[model samples]
Target chain A: MPALRKGRCLSPILLALMLVAGLIALPPGGRLTANEPQARLHNVDIREFAFMPAELTIRLGDAIVWTNRDFAPHTATSAEGDWDTSEIAYGQSSRQTPTQLGVFDYICVFHPTMKARLIVTR
Target chain B: MTPIKTTLLAGFAVFALTLPAFAQAGLDDLEVAHAAYTADVIDIEYAKLALSKTKNPEIKKFAELMIRDHTAVNEGAAALLKKLGVQAKDNDFSKALLKGFEAKKKELSALDGAAFDRAYAANELAYHQTVNKIVGETWIPTVKNGELKAFLSQALVTFKAHENHAGHMVTAAK
Candidate 1:
């Protein structure tokens, strides 16, 4: 009974702290709306001469950040030559928000063997 | 012996003497940096030569890539050395690399058009293979500095990718 009481007593306090932490972690100008999904940031790491996630799927409004974790420079360039995150150097990053919904193939212009796919959905 | 042949043999003898230094386990951080930078410069020079001689778009593009990537890697190496407040030390391995480069460059310079492209691509394949092996199996393991070791590890990945690309170029140039 005592342990049960302690659990009941801490639940609301812990919930309040988590809520506050979530609010603080929100992006600038982000609002918690009940009817709409929030845009998110996804990371794609370049390491060991390859992309961490060779394929990715994200929502239309979400952004993808390609971080070059390798010493050599890399780029996230669309195979169709439409979008390019030109030269993300070592320990650097670049972000791209997809403007259309479809599957897009990309490669590092420097190392064409580095290929990946991005699927943007509604 | 003919003068050019004699000179070539003497150059090879000198380069062979330096080969042990390259294979020895005593390479310091600065020596490794010097060798890595020298390799970059050699590749860049080869690429520049290729660019000047080749009209094939694929070969031209590969040459441009070599110039861009090698220059970028060299710049990164320079920045890291400056940040560490150290300079790359000149060593026998770097000297040997330059000596070999001089002869190879002269050989490549004598060719034009397809022959030049094929030779350039073949050299790139061989060069990247050698550099990648040294950086991965030799320098990265023996480097005493943490930052330098990490830098060499990252550079090895890039160079391995270059090796693969160069292999493709060799096939395409033929």
Candidate 2:
């Protein structure tokens, strides 16, 4: 009878332990941990009238943040009028996350000579 | 009206009408060069003050750019003047602009921190706007020399960009 009671006690404890393990295995936000890739952030600095990395390559869904370190205002204006960062003042930043796969050429509307290329790939 | 008084009034009216014309006679190549040089110098002077007085990184960067770009412009103007065998001549407009800049510098020096940044940025915006207008509307049309006109035209493009940058600075300071 004592052994039977001990088994009865062990059953709930085992169930609780199994429940906790299941909870731990589940991903945060209850989302599926399957084939979804994570997005990433990349930084591009503007200084001395030019982008630090004048050309950048990134995968789709990745974001690029452009920070203006120069005293003058700058704009990341797309050549095809697809995207623009308006006027990024000194020490200010703007972000662009390209969804399409293509090469986007941009220039500072204020400083036409300032140019950069962003390539997005699958 | 009495005859002498009428004559005097007519003379004054003639002077008034011609006064605008005289002022609108616009700057000669030498005066234009001088004005351009003086303007750059004034910008550099104010920028140096901004650099020393402000702690904001944005304003400091702007001040540095002002110093760099204006210095380059001044050097270019000087070289152009030398190449053309023309001596820069001072004019009433340039003198007044210098005086205004001096007063602005004094006012800006009295402030600190964000106040200084705001005032400096606003002043830069106003200054560039005025310069852009003068270069585009007055100087470009009235400049008699071919090279000088082209120079003013080119400088107008730069001034327009500066004006836009200054406008951004003004908003950022606010």
Candidate 3:
């Protein structure tokens, strides 16, 4: 009976070692699992005195990032006084995640001529 | 010629020659307005050159802002002049400013790439600073017309912002 119990324990240990070995033998590029949650992201490049895409459309719950590629500082200020990213410096980024669905117009207070629109859809 | 007649003729010639200089010396409200307008034009010109020559996105953006804002200011000045029944007069100071800008443009045109961007940014910073100082200290105080003074005062706000922006660019370039 003692020998039988020892055999049972050794069999489980061997099985566990085989499973770990199998995992190690798998290809480097192979994915172990899936079903991870990832947030949707959009990028707006502020370049050449204007936003590359002056208008951006996204779905609700999605996030948009503005990257300033200019030498000077800029701001994304809402026309209606709703939201504002005070100042985005050179090579820096600012993000906005809008919950509401509508068309929003924004401009740089420093350069009022620099305007852009963001549209969010449900 | 008689001595008295010769002296009178010399006096007349002196007065005739010096009149233009005297007119330019103390810029009246009209002349000051014209000079301000001309300064905007000069800034726009330099910005256009920068836009054409620079590949750096930051510098290009700055140049574009300069062009757009200065053009708007110029247009506003034009409309105001038209409404006020005033003609923008060319004066010695404005002429000298343009000449200096021409030299600066030549210097900038000779540079390329990063060198061009740094030089352009530095020049912009200096230009805005000088303009801000002139508008705030000299032009604003000396302007005689209420409307013109109000315009200059408003313009000074814009220029101060530009000066701050340019200062940032200069620092970033370094």
Candidate 4:
């Protein structure tokens, strides 16, 4: 009887974890916030058909933030990469910390021509 | 479950879990959208890089469109994330994909004139089609949020048109 009860309880817990895991598996960025250590104090502004600072630099532990100030919506995304906030919208911001040190480039999803670069370093 | 319960459950699941909850959370659906979201952004960057090196007018035009459309979607998504309170992501998969795209872009950019145009268009067509399939099969069914569902749906429509146009450009170039 104890064993049966234990099994029942355990399954729901496991089931719950699995569900959480599923959502976590979604791409980065769509679920990002303005505050994340990955891109510490990094700012991205969307205006005039371009993302300002087409080139930005931040600490490895820091983040790069994008705020869509343009009349049109714009996303700051990595072409072949993933991000905490793969995209950002007007009057909104997203952040992420680059785990590694290198130059990362991203573009606005709506307007691919609007590209920007993030240089993450120690 | 009753509609009210279902809606409640779905809402709770989003706060407690993630996208396209297959059984309850539809994690796969969210992943598909996330993946496409990631891929779209990556493509946008690639398009920019391609435009800089390529001389073709049509290709340049397409790159510009990617910037505009992707920005809207990303921003819309960011707004939702804010409401959800879930943290933004910078996972290994996204990092690696960007690296690969950069390498490929470098290789493709090495070509010039018509060859460059042909390669760029070919890549765009392939990328868009794959994204369409992933979103259609994995994302649409999994997503439970009413607003997010609608957003993805509209994005897909725009994406399909973009793919069609890219295909036309590639074929015309050839």
Candidate 5:
């Protein structure tokens, strides 16, 4: 059926629609809509000496964590001093409360070559 | 050893010693990547929400790309975590995002058609511009890897494209 095909092919389309609908339906100060898992995330791989995820999205109240897999140290610093990791050491971590909702831009302070986005939904 | 060879040998030894600190700094993001990635997933959700409901066709397409590409990119990030031997737990930031999005959902929904498009476009412009500055100003110079340097060099491409798109929409709206 074309409906099924559309569903399959345009799954991303439907997802886009739902994403917007979800935002439009978001409550003030960001209240979780569904009782879905709290840590719904997209991991960013730092390999080939690059920030793999490049950009990512998370709900308000969610967190964005970074890891250093390569042979060099990297940092996840937010632009405009919004939020940042103070040089997450190799095999170490940093965490933050993205309570404020907005598209936050960040980069690894050490590498300057590693960049990522933390999109906090609200 | 030849004079040039001696110089090269010394450089290699010093380079090896200095490289560890560079790697150590990069690894720090790993500590935050998992949690950060989840929060960012929420951002994509918002961008898509704005796109689908917008009256503007271009905004719609761009939103679609944001959703699809970002999803793939995020997934890749997950695999990267596995490769690097990292495990992530759901943290407070993710909880806050869910709560915030649920709160803002209705207002964003109310802005329909052109109004929705304008808001969405403006938001995109802001987001991409910030991304560009961070990548150019921060990420590009963060690492010691030559390959990464070149790869990061291209990050501005998408941000610039979004800027142009959003700029057009904003200009059209005025």
Candidate 6:
């Protein structure tokens, strides 16, 4: 009975080990597993009439959230008219996910001097 | 500071020193709020006049931004005052700002076409420079209320941005 109990205890341990090993052994660039890095959310800040990073890079599926730390309202509007996070007021935030993979230049419509760029990669 | 900023500061200091209204020791919290709110209203008025008179796209865009931003700032000031359960008291500084606005209105009303746009751009630049100087150098230091001080600090950043934008517009309009 002691040996039987030992076997039962080792079963889950071995299974967990196998699962981890399987995840590790999965082919690169094949398919995303439970342990693979997934889409991420990045943050940008607007303060003193400028974007904190002024430029960013992310994966295709990643998202960016812009928070206004200035008293004035602002927007992240794409130069090509592709996307716009419009009228983000003080203490407010807006989010965007780029569907296309490339470089995009954007500016605050209210204050055109405020400029930034985003790089999206697959 | 940049040369332009230094010039703006020196010019604003002279303008402020000339105004007997702001030379007082300091303004109370309500008085500060009143002056800030009045400034917002005056900018909105100027923007409206710009919209009515100018056909230039750049000037029109700048005017629209002034109206939207100043209106928003005034609304925020009004909400904060309501929350504190007090009304902003009209002081000499506020009165002086209104008087100055009336004088500028008459001056701007006399111009037309590109001349009007150029004058409007220059006025916006000077107005922002003066307001930013006062808000940064005066009210932020003297206001006793923590919330009001914080509000002014944030508003100063926006006004400073406006000063820079106006500088660019002044060049473009010319």
Top candidate on lDDT is: 6
DockQ of all models, two decimals each: 0.40, 0.03, 0.02, 0.10, 0.02, 0.44
Off by over 4 Å in 3: A1-122, B1-24
In candidate 5, stretches whose alpha carbon ends up further than 4 angstroms from where it belongs are A1-122, B1-27, B35-40, B88-106, B139-157
Error of 4 at A80 (Å): 40
Docking level for model 3 = incorrect
Off by over 4 Å in 4: A1-122, B1-33, B88-100
Better of 1 and 4 by lDDT: 1
Off by over 4 Å in 6: A1-33, B1-17, B20-25
TM-score of every model versus the real structure: 0.82, 0.56, 0.56, 0.47, 0.39, 0.82
DockQ leader: 6
Relative to the unseen true structure, what is the C-alpha lDDT of residue A4 in candidate 4, on a scale of 0 to 100?
A: 13
Interface RMSD for each predicted structure: 1.8, 7.7, 9.8, 6.8, 11.2, 1.4
Residue B33, model 5: Cα distance from true site in angstroms? 2.2
**CAPRI grade, predicted model 1:** acceptable
For candidate 1, give the lDDT of residue A119: 96
lDDT of 6 at A18: 60
Q: In candidate 5 chain A, what residue range of length 10 has the lowest lDDT sum? A: A1-10
Ten contiguous residues with the weakest lDDT in model 1 chain B: B1-10
lDDT of 2 at A5: 13
Q: What is candidate 4's TM-score against the reference?
A: 0.47
Worst 10 residues of 4 chain B by lDDT: B15-24
lDDT of 4 by residue, A12-54 (tens): 5765675466522212433322222333366777665567878
What's the lDDT for candidate 3?
Answer: 0.73
